[model samples]
Target: MKKKKLLLTTALVGTMAFGATIPTSLAHDALGSDVNKGEERIVFSNEDLKTLESSLLKGRKNVGNFYEAAAVQIQELEGVQNNTADVYAHNGYAYLGTHTANGGNGGVRVFDLKDPSNPVEIAVFAHDVPYTWQEKVIVKSVNTPHFKGDLAAVSVQQTSRNNSSRPDSVGGVLLYDVTDPTDPQKLGFYQLDRRITGTHELYLTTQGNRALVLASSPYADYYTHGENEDFQIIDVSDPSNPEKLWGSDPRELEEISEKFNGYHWDAPDGHTRPVFNHSVITDNNGQYAYVSMWDLGTVIFDIQDPENPVYLGRTEYRDDQKGAAHSAALARGGNILIETREVSNPVGDGYEDAYGYTRILDIKDKTNPVLLSEFTTELTYDIPETSQGRTTFAKTVHDPKVHGNTLYLSYYSGGVIMVDITNPNNPTEIGRYTPESANVWGVFVDRNYVLASDMGQGLKVLARGNKVVNNGKGR
Candidate 1:
């Protein structure tokens, strides 16, 4: 009676620092989510942090969704390393991570994913903006967009890679009122006076008492240094009070698209757009706000009055903005905007559905966004060109979750994908639950549970029904 094996795909051998070298781009999934039998998942890897480090150092206290209780491992106080602690969810209980690990100098790692496979790390929003006395600079942002009725808007921009401190690039904008995710108290943080660096990515509009936050830093400086940005609008109708007002940064999108109206521009092309850190798809009643912008492609905003937002224009596909139109969706109250391409995918044949497709534009003429047609993914995998697709892992469809009409995509190694836009131009991939744990970066469905975010396997809660479906009590 012994079966709990979860060493995944190639038996994850990455512990970093313990003899160095673990990068072939992270030796594929590094032991996480290669699941098959019974299939209810969990793999918070590092071998479940080495079998839960003696039950997380015997501290207990695990409750989530907001004010993330506590468990330490604070990514070594915001310098994360090794297989690290990759966790991010926004609905399966509001969370986001990267206080360290994947990007050397990083910030922002919070949680409260209440029982979404145990998420509880309450507070530590140190992007460091002291400035005056100790001269502070590091406040890096990796997309902290949360709004399930409360507040938590984060998107810092300052990267000459960190260049050991400063080579230019710093726009550490931060705002929080998480209603109290273990006390997130920091009503404001805006340090973008242009020495470089700008808003990373945010798309929250909020109503009632009002809120704005649109932010964008498409890549702050074009190529590497930072500054091709444009996505600035912060008027936090007082979540403790924060205000920036107007915003725009579009250095003509670093100019790499020789052509983008008839197709024919592909060079490591995640399809030209690369400025908006991650996403901004709204419209399930959020009024209508879809802004992707990297190589410059998806920008359709009109947030009723979420504060002066009226850019109603953009949809200029592939002039080669260099892979950053990343992820987007507006499915439900549909006008169309389901874009993809976190890293461009078209390795033909070997059948991988050419990398989780999604391109359906035509935002009912918000200036102009009409590409209507391009979606072909139903779990196609064959990878074996010497594993050029690299050990063939999947789950980087990179964040996309909508419910009413169904969109749910987290595909880092390509798993958690379940489109069914009730026909948003034939987008019907339908039912799925494939968590063999590739790098499924962030997702949250709630009501029926789905809470994903299993990079090294940290937050994976399936819960639907049948095969032992009780979610307890209902048992």
Candidate 2:
């Protein structure tokens, strides 16, 4: 008996085309780890074309219309490449990340949101690194002993697994001083091992006088062959001197093994479900950290002590559920959690019948979290029978943002769907803003309006029309 080995190969197609001179040593490496395994290669086979056509047709069918109670679009700023990734709003400005889907160099785009209806592009943080992409960016106002101003942390990842050994290739987090959004000054770069690829998602928090950055390195153990941890905490209290404070692999924890009885290592579907950290978010006080583990659910950690973190309990999924646990947000004074599962392939291997949706959990009991309820939209369960087994990225929920009792979600082609989670157990859809050709990747709620990052159409400023009443504190 022999073990099955999977090798990733890149096919030249559109702007994702690769060069003919692929290094032989790098050809056998896997594309990525966990949920993003083997996604870099853009092979345009017959089946691939069929899937693309199906997604486009589905988008067209539901295009150019808004829900009766839909939020009105105030303004839209087209992206430089129309390949926007994630968006973050702070103070009176909006920052957007760039993707490598169209062979464009990754960077951070800044816009002045002072005038909500008219966002002005103020600056662009050009990422000169070749063969890499910046998919996530988060800006936080810090008042530390060394640096006290606006700090931006951007996640950088290699575009392809085969280019790991290229001299020009780089992977890690880039820090910038954006206190002056118009002229962002480079502070420092936190470099990761080449084998680890890079950080896919990041979060910044201020623990007292010390500021820290929590980075999620997806499938790091698989790539390094158990040599490194996937989640890392870096002490960025001094923007110029970024140092690693702590690192941990959730799978190696005793409580995780005992709770699931080691079932996470080898799932019942005859496939090895590798546990990896997909994304992370911390409480307002930075006392606890919630990590979104792809197949092992969301693992909680107590980080009151920056040097040492204690393992808390994690969320659980049913036997029939394909565990993704992509991203999450905290609400209701950090007692409730909004978890979004990006299950792009939803109709095979005995999985559910629809795309990913929102799951509300009561985390008041950190040691033993409880599932309160689940929220789904028409696109989540209304997949056509013909597109059941085919993989499409257009219909799944990508991110979550909460303002008061309202929950905003980025539903790719399904557009932005809003829900009223006043009752955690029974969330109801209150509003939506679906554009003519929407491919929204992220959503952010501000004091006055909401900002959505659409991959194809760029930044869209939306008004909830007094629907969002600040009855409770928002995340």
Candidate 3:
């Protein structure tokens, strides 16, 4: 990987755009973080988009406690040439994924973070496959059968609703050799049939020498194919040649659907939707894979044997309950599971009173899962929720990540929230950062900084202010 030289120019403040120079003069204390104090390439520039600047100015005026100027705003990266989605930092490099924005192509942007304040973009990766929408990227080192070194996995989703429209429309996972951050070599591209909705979200784990990728195909379901799609697991032991290890049993669709009230269907876009897998994660030891099925609750799959996966147990929700089982993470030594729902559809009361928060499930027993509690931010009550098709960005819980006793979440427009889940029964919000023009898609709390990807803006680098206990978890 090669590093790029840093440049400096004047910036207007929270503006959005692709690739530009920002001077140190724009670095103000009001933004909450300390500027590097020298000529450097600021990751973000306000001069690019005046709207973003206005939003930041407004956000600063009425900042809340959790978001109150505690964390330092290290850097902001806008005009990255793509709409940022999920973000991952590894080996001094930040791999930022992209979403399908305005029919633009999706890919990943690699930034050299050796100099956090002056991060530089060294590479952009996109596959040559058709209907290829790369939204998420996961990187890890693999010592598999024939592969050993740094490997990156990215998701490929449907380019259009109908895969047949593009005969070569392929959707699945793409593996890459990212040993060198500047260059990502394609290892393998996995594709499912046109009938299935491609990979939406996924997770990667290493067991022994083989690498496993748990892919979430959220569009494949019983109503469409007469069977719900099981999250797929692939063995990338051989980076050049990947093989399907196992998948959820389609036969168990009706059984699980019945448990989740037979799939909560709502297609405001006029397209009849089906049940699907949204996210998949495994325990640290690779023993259990927690799969979150939208509207179907969470399903536990025993993956002790890489080649074989067995159904363990699942969570149950009620009809009157507001549920959108979207994604989850394991914590407390895999004894506790933190699940997040992705919905803001109004119920009887109206969008203003919609419910979409994080749920804590107890998986102490593999056979029976129990819901322990739920966590929500004050912003949920302050923001006005709207219908699914409407702009409910800041009203819903997008994702949750646990590091020690703290829970870092990315709320669409709510910015990034930090919660203290020390007590499983009572999760409290200790800190939060909601940008004025917030439209946060994903968040990752790194060793030295908190990384957030905003759909409307771009990447935000923040420091957990002195108010945070630091408890040595973020390291």
Candidate 4:
């Protein structure tokens, strides 16, 4: 197995995070896990939580360099949670997410960020599911492999603890024609209903004229079913009327039932049906797809040919043996895949034992993906050590986002951790932010800004500082 080293600092521990301006008073605020009124809701607050979240962007000399003080708070949204960011601009583009209760047609929402700070909701789309459904979407454009303008895809979360609409499958992907953001049309939708699965996070691959939708179906849409969840690859070339040309195949791997994370991961008596699929990030060219294959770790696929997604290799998130990879992103350039290791449920497992973390995998070898480095912070005593705050107990790092050469993460209770991965081998935590009440669920970043999808706080846009406007011209 080959390894990619983080050209930057090996590891920057106990570092002070750039202040995203969450008032020193609310500075200890967390990103997610907030109970609004009575029900648990993900909120991004600007009240007293200043927008400018600027902290020093660190790295090992030749590794990487990010802005320090230019950060500013731009906007905040109420419902979206997790890394459902669609920042690539096209037309009057912005960001999109699967928000609200997580299921139903209302699960989908979009923001118009033509104005960076004040993001406006353009549209929403979703179909009913066993629970509340959430979503992720991207509009097609040139430069993209398929480059079919006006086309886009969204992965819907059809089930959650909030609802009983348990899906025959977790959920499905909906194709849309968003030429007119004000009035978007649902072109098509397809479900991988083999088990009660949720298409957590997925991406559209440029195949031919039609894009192939590669989605991950998460098991346990409600609370008792994740053990049997798995993944499926669908062919939605015909958006208006998509088809499941693939999937329904044997779960390449079997899920072993063990007292791992503690959660009552069903099938305790024996190995439950494997829950495959999850995070799927692509190379710069969109030629290949790197997926966070849940218990399978990070799997690299040779998608040079999208339709026949040839599986090249797989990595074990738990180890050559234990835990699991919940979400992953291609980092350290296209050759490496960054995997977020975790378990959906932890019954009585010790917090430290849960050991959720991030791993860097070398995917250049294809058939033999290699692990480079891993990082984890000490969990707070209050963070949930059980089920990932589905709608209850909270805490744990859920998603990691890569921008430039640095990686920004949303830690459930650990707060926001920024790592410098100039060298994949040794990642450094340049800074971190953990507000007292924040239960961070997901994160998204652009050129120089980071946004934490806080369940109770709204959308916290962090930047260096309010861009200081200079008045002196001829100083």
Candidate 5:
């Protein structure tokens, strides 16, 4: 267990924004319970309600100095309920994905970003069913198997907080012809069987005339089933027709499951040994797929042969430290792997448990990799006791994006933290923006601006330019 800690500040909670905090009775849980359930749905029982009653706390009070307030938030696209999970931007359009919420149906929100500051809500792709649980969408130009100019893929998780109310809900991926950003056509629907849980996140790629999809099935692992259910691959070259290509080897999955059967998790309740794929990413060439396997560390696979993947290697974690391995990004021509860990609980003065941080690994030699350094910001909390307040400075990483030498991370309650990874061995926090009620889920860095999806707010476009002085100049 090599613990590589960088020079990090244990103070400065970041820019402070004052807002009205919702009461516990009116506040809802984040993504719901993570208890025993094959469908990974949110089930708020009497006990859950009782817990929520006692979890009401105050809002954020202090601000950190390290926070530059440099990343100026230019625009905020509000959704029905604002459970935005991921954002995918194309030529001039931004596709925003949403999770199920109280007053909204989970669906895809498309905006014409022809104007960055003032985006127009041109179209929306949502299911007509009573219960909808869409978490992510990917839009890209393609000349694949069926010659579809532009395509969009959306994920529908079959689980829900109230399972009985979503009887007709099913889990799978939905394909659409988005050649026209304003009007998307339903191309196909690739639904999965009940044997496995719904797809949580998908890694999509295109080569020549073929499109590949590697889905991250969260709860359906080898231990739960007799086969490898975590990393299932599918070929959707033909937009109208999709096919399941292959999945990770069951034998390999079984081996790892047995090895980590006694692995300790970071659950606030107790130690729970479980393995699941939180997300996966492929290199530009689509030669390999890196999986963020929770508690199992990061797993690598050679996917040059999309039909048959070969296990390459994986990173090891200390027994004393729990592995939350949530998401990752590749940098320096895929030589370095930057991974983020998802923390389920809260930390700081009022919380009971702590969480993991961002890690930089030197994978120039995939077989024999080295941990370069680890980065984490100072954790601060306003009301650490309640459900809403506990997330304050819940310094957990949800997703990350790498542009050249800079790494952009969506740090849940920690807001967004940008690190200068020019020197991978000494990654330092360059800039950060923590909204008063920040619960950022995804972040993507573009040419000029960075797009982040917040669980409470929709799409936010931020610029990493000049800092904000008492009376700062635009230039």
Candidate 6:
């Protein structure tokens, strides 16, 4: 076991100040400067943990009342573990990813959703990955020449930044042949370079006869010492032979530096914000990609040719607004884009005392995305002035999933917020569900039911109608 100490201060303490915990093996080191010098490892000190505990306590106080409109929780499954990270619903099943909490070894859990209200855990995949955790899992149906049927892609990240040099460490994408939900067969793994940790987020889609995966490697340049790119496109037509098609480096893009050069308020205490791809998603046709570059805004690229990506444009933030361009989803015939900003620091220099919210953008013109409207919950805007400076994991918006004209947002402590995106310009909250203690990480809207992954809780199945069919017993 090895330990890496981080000398974190105000600026360096963004989302890391939340509930992110490192393994005991990786203890805190106080040998460096007050600010992080691009070290990949994320370790917190006792003081930081105290701050998190205090923040969570204060945040729960403001969790508000339990409310639901046009939606009801039909089923809930406290997963095999407590650190569930994300969930993806497909066909008649749900795949849940886990984080590196409690222990470093965490994997994906698959559930049978035949009975929407009574999901049963059928199989668990990739739990054998040593010293690793999975944050994103996406399963897509492929009909390419090399493969056909349901394919699952799970992102594996090493628990410690320095663990990449160890032989038993796992850091990459693990593919699985989950055509059979009850029994998933291991297909292949697309391991990241040693210098790079692993894929934080990814989007799997099919283009023509080829199946492609757009993997976002956050801060890859800093970890790899500027030798690798942050965004990678891989051709997984054959699950057993996943090949890299191309990579996109945000630092090379002139627009990135040009648009965010003078944005100091969003930067860490005394440091400049680093530009890198935090997450990515493609259009329905898989011809274009929207890469969420933190502080750089959501960058758009033409990926018709997987090998060559053409830069189009990106969304911008006002000088006073904190930019964390976290994750995004397209809606309304691909004309409307919903971008969620994950501002971990509620009150900071030159910024308001508020958590991140959803930003509605009109991307009808690929060259320029115009901000249509901004949506924020009462918790995001009304945090107590007493708890303004602390980091609260409960308030910020994490992920968004759109179905038809509705936007299902997984808001941390705010729970799952259902918004009417029929009119992107004037977005209105049509419904919301906040558990007694909610920490929603990812959300997915399938058919008539919605699946939300809560970090503290587990798999939550909610539907629009009042009568949710429950044939079997809870697992």
Better of 1 and 5 by lDDT: 5
Which residue runs does candidate 6 get wrong by more than 4 Å?
Answer: 1-82, 164-166, 256-271, 386-389, 468-475
Q: Report the CA-based lDDT of candidate 2 relative to the real structure.
A: 0.69
Candidate 6 lDDT, 248-297, residue by residue in tens: 65434443331232111123233244356779999999988999977778
- RMSD of each predicted structure: 23.3, 10.4, 14.6, 11.7, 12.0, 10.8
Greater TM-score among 2 and 5 belongs to 2
Candidate 6 lands at a TM-score of 0.79
Q: How many steric clashes between backbone atoms does each model show? A: 49, 0, 16, 68, 5, 3
Question: On lDDT, who's better, 2 or 5?
Answer: 2
Candidates in order, TM-scores: namely 0.29, 0.80, 0.77, 0.67, 0.76, 0.79
Computed on alpha carbons, the lDDT of every model, listed in order, comes to: 0.45, 0.69, 0.62, 0.50, 0.61, 0.67
What lDDT does candidate 3 reach at residue 279?
Answer: 85
Candidate 1 segments exceeding 4 Å error: 1-40, 43-45, 49-107, 110-123, 126-152, 155-212, 215-233, 236-240, 243-299, 302-306, 311-357, 360-365, 380-436, 442-475
lDDT of 2 by residue, 1-475 (tens): 1111211111111221222232332211112423233123231322322233211211112221221121122122233332567889998888888666556454888888776656787887848667677778999999999999999999888776436367676678889999999999999888887766678899999988899999998866556554556788999988788998887754344433322221234544444454677899999999988998877778888888867777777777776676678899999999998899877665654455667778999989887779999998877876666854445667778899988887889888777787888899998886666655567788988766778876654676764333322322111
Model 4 local distance difference test score:
0.50
Give residue 121's lDDT in candidate 3 (0 to 100): 72
Question: For candidate 1, which ten residues in a row score worst on lDDT?
Answer: 55-64
Q: lDDT tens digits, residues 1-475, model 4?
A: 3222201111112222222222221111111111111134434334534542333233333223222221122233344232232223345444445344322334445556565455566655554343444546655642233334577777665434233453243456777777777677776777544343356677766644546666766432212232323344566656766765444222232332222221222232232213345567667566776776454457666666444556566675331223456677776557777777653333322223343567887877766777798765665233453544532224445677887677877776555678888888998877665554555566777654555654444444444433432321000
Q: Model 5, range 1-475, lDDT digits (tens) per residue?
A: 2222111111221222212232232111112232111121232322332332121111111212221211112122242333566888888787887665553355787877766665676777755434556677877788864756778888767545236655666667788888998888888877765444467788778766788777886655432433335667788888678888776532243233222321222333233434567688899988888988775678887777777666667776554454667788999999999988766554422223556578899987775567999887665223356666454324556688998988888876666777888899998777666644566777877775667766655666654443443322121
Q: Estimate candidate 6's alpha-carbon lDDT, on a 0 to 1 scale.
A: 0.67
* The best candidate in terms of TM-score: 2
**Regions more than 4 Å wrong, model 3:** 1-46, 49-80, 163-165, 222-228, 253-274, 348-353, 379-391, 464-475
